[model samples]
Target: MASSDSTASVPDLPSKPPAWANGSPSVRRPAFQWAPYLFLLPTVGLLFLFSLYPMLYGVWMSLRTTDVIHGTSTFVGLNNYLQLFHDPQFGLSVLNTAWYTLTVVPLIVAGSIAIAVFLRDSRPARLLARVGFYVPFVLSPVVVATSWKWLLNEDLGVINGFLKWAGLATIPWLSSDFSARVSVVVATAWNLVGFYMLMVLAGLSQISAEFYEAARIEGATGWHRFWHITLPMLRPTILLVVILATIHATQAFETILLLTDGGPGGATRLVVQNMYQSAFGRLQPGYGVAQAVVLLPVILFVAWLQMRLFKQEGVI
Candidate 1:
C-alpha cells in the first residue's frame, strides 16, 4: 500500500529522446508569431530594389553634376532645378503635358463612363461591336502609332482624301503645332477610351439593378436615375479612371516619341521627352535624373490628393 501510494504521488517526468534519433536543434522562429514576416521578406526586397532604389538614386544623381565620360559627380545644389525654370523648352513641355492631361482626363473619364453605362447591360448588339472596341487596347503601341501616322498623313492619307472628296480642304493633321498637339490628344483618347470603358463597365456591373428598378417605381426619370443613381454608384470607378489616366498622361512617351518626337519645335514635347533629351541628347544623365526626381514629389502629392478623394468616396 505504501509503495503504491508513493508511486501514485510521484509526477511523471518527461523523458528526452536520444540526440542522434531526433536530430540537431534547429533555430526556428515560431510559425504563428513570425512566419508571416518571413514570407514578406521577398516582397520587401523587391520593392526596395525595383521601386525605392531607382527613385532614390535618381534623386541623388539629380542633385549632382557629372560629365558623361569622366564619371566624377559634384553636388550642384538646386542649379539644375533652377535651370529647368529658366529653360523655355521645359516650360513648353510642362504646358503641353498639362494640356494633354486636361484634354484626355475629362474626355476619357466622362466618355468611358457614358459608353460603359450604355454597354454594360447592352443586349442584342452584334458581338463584333465588343471585339472592335477592345481590340485597340491589345494592339501594340508601335502599331497604333504607325497606323495613325499613315492615316493622318497630310498629302496621301485616307483622312485627307476623304476630306477632299467631301469638298473640304485637307487640314494639316500632323503639321501645325496647334493641330499636331490636338491630334495627339485625340489619338490617345481613341486608343485608350475603350480600356477605360471596360473598367467602368465592370464597376457598373457590380452594382445591383434592383436599385434602378426601385427608383423607377418612385417616378424617377431617365436623367434623374442617371444623375442620382448611376453617377453616385460609379464615383469609385470614375475616380480610379481619372487617377490612372493622369498617370498615363504624365508618363506618355511611346506615342509622343514615335509620333511627334516632341516636335514642331518642342511645342508638343512633354517632361519625359525632356528627360530623354537630357540623358541621351545632351549626355547630361544626371540632369535628366534630377528632373525626374523633382517631378516625382509632384506626382506623389497629386496621387495622395486623389486617394483622399477615394477615401471620401469610401473606396479606400
Candidate 2:
C-alpha cells in the first residue's frame, strides 16, 4: 500500500513527437543561401574568362585568315583546313608524330612496368632506387633536353668518348636522320619513364594481397601470378598510361625543340612543332589554328578507341 502511494505521487509527463516524425519541417533554413555560390563565383568567372574564351576565339580564328601586318581578319571558311590536306610538310609532321607515339608509348609502358615491379618491395635499396629513377622527372624539360644534347654530341660527347675508349666507331647521334630520331626517342622515354613508374606503383598498391595468397595456395609461380593476376588488375592503369603517353608523343615540341630543332632532314619534326612554326615563324595564324583544331579530333578518336578496346576486354 505504501509503494502504491509513492508511485501515485509521481507527476505524469506529457510525450511529444519530433517535428520530422509529425510530418512538419525539422530544419529552419536561412533566408540567404547564396554563400556557396558566392564562394564558387571567382573560379567559374576565371575559367570562362581564360579557357572558354580563348578556345572560342581560336575556333573563330581558325575559320578566318588574319593579316598580321594590318591586324585584320578575313573569313575564309575551311580553306585553311583544306590546304592542310595537300601540304606535304604537314603530312610528314603527322607521320613523324605517329611514329613517335607508336615507339615511345610501348617503350614507356614496358620500362615503367618492369621498374615498378622490381622496386615494389619496401627495402632501403629499392626505395633509393625509386628516388633515383624519379629524380629526372622533377627536372625541367629544357634542362633535360639540353643535358642530353651535350651527352649525344657527335664529336666530343660523353657517349662517343666512351665508345672511343672501348675502341668502337663513334656514331653521329644527332646528325644522321636515323640516329637523330633514335636519340630523340631515347631521350623522351628516359624523361617520362619515372613518372609512369609511379602510376604503375599506384596501381600495384590497389591490388589485394588475398589474390596473391590464393594464387600461391594454388601453386602458381611468379610469372603465372603476374600474368593472370597483376596484369589483369592493372589493365585500367595501363590504359590510362597508354592514352597519356600517346597524347604526350603527339604534342611533343619543347624537348625536340631544344635537342634537335627538327633537324637532320626533318626526321624528328612533329605536328605541334610544325604548327608552332606556321603560326609564329611563318605568321600564318589561320593555318596553324587549323592544324591544332584537326589534332583535337585525332587525339579524341585515339583515346576513344582505346577506351572502346578496353571495354570490350572488360578492363574498364
Candidate 3:
C-alpha cells in the first residue's frame, strides 16, 4: 500500500516531440531545421535552372541533328557516336589529347609543388617568382602566340638566330609535326605553371607550422620532413592540381592551334580542336558533340576518384 501511494504521487511526464516536429512551440529543437534549407533555396534553384537545365538540354540536342535555333534535325540516336569511332581525324585528336594530358599533368603538378615548397617561407622570393610565373597567364593568348610566332619564325626568327649563334641547326619549330607538338607543350606549360604554383602555395599555407616544428624537434632533416609530413599533407593539393591540369590539358586547343595548327600534318591536333573544326569548319555539329561526350565521363570519373581516395586531405 505504501509503494502504491508513492507511485501514484509521482507525476506522469509529457512525451518528447518527434524529430520532424522540431519547429513546434515548447518542443526540443533539431540540430538544424528548415531555416538552413530556406537559405539554400536560391542557390539550389539557380544551379538547377542554369547549369543542370542547360546540360540536360545539350544532351537532348546531341541526340538530334537539327540547328539549335531552327531545331530542324531529326533524332539520330547513336549514329553521331558511331561516326566518331570511324573518323581518322577524331582518332588522332583523341590520341593527341591523351598524350598531352599524360605528360603535362604530372609536370605541372610536380613543378608547381617544388617551386611553392621552396618559396613558401621566403616572402620576397615568392613574390618575385610569382610575378614571373603568372604574367603570361593574364596576357591574351593571341598576343602571346603572335609574339612567339614572330620569334619562332622558320627563317630570320630570333629563336633560329640564337640557335645559329650557338652552332645549332635552325629547325622549323612550328612547320613540322614533331617540333610543333613540343612547341605547344612548352608554350602552354610556361603560361600555366604559375597558376598551378599559386594553388600549391595555398595548400602549403594551410598546413600547420607546428607539424614542421614537431618534426624538427625529433631531429627530422629536410628530406625527412618533406617525405613524412609535407607530401602526405599535400596529397589533396596534388590531386587538385592533377584534376585541374588534366581538364586544361584535355581541353587543350587554343595554344596548339595558335602555335602549330595541329600540323606538319595533324600532328598536334587535340580532341577539342577536332570538335571545334567539326562543329564550325566542317559543319558537323552532331559528330563534334559526340566526340566531346566521349571525354565527359573520363573527366568526371577521375575527379570522383580523387575525392574518394583523398577524403581526409581536409581540402575544401
C-alpha positional error of residue 103 in candidate 1 after TM-score superposition, expressed in Å:
1.0
The digit string of per-residue lDDT tens for model 1 on 139-204 reads 777888898899999898999999999999899988789989888888788888888877776677
Q: What digit string (tens of lDDT, one per residue) describes model 2 on residues 159-270?
A: 9999999999999999899999999999999988888887887788778899999999999999999999999999987987888888766645789988999987789999
- By lDDT, the better pick of 1 and 2 is 2
Indicate which candidate wins on lDDT.
2
lDDT by residue (1-316, candidate 3, tens digit) is 3242111122333345334555676656544567868989999999999977866776776676857567568899988887777889888988888778877877788888898898888877766766787787787778777877887888878999999999999999898877787777877777688888877876787688899999999999999999999899988778778877877776457767887777878889888888889888877677777777787789779878777755554332
lDDT of 3 at 117: 90
Off by over 4 Å in 1: 1-43, 124-130, 305-316
TM-score of each: 0.82, 0.82, 0.76
lDDT of the candidates, in the order given: 0.79, 0.83, 0.77
Which residue pairs clash within candidate 1?
none
RMSD of 3: 13.4
Question: lDDT score, residue 55, model 3?
Answer: 65
Stretches > 4 Å off in candidate 3: 1-50, 66-71, 206-221, 303-316
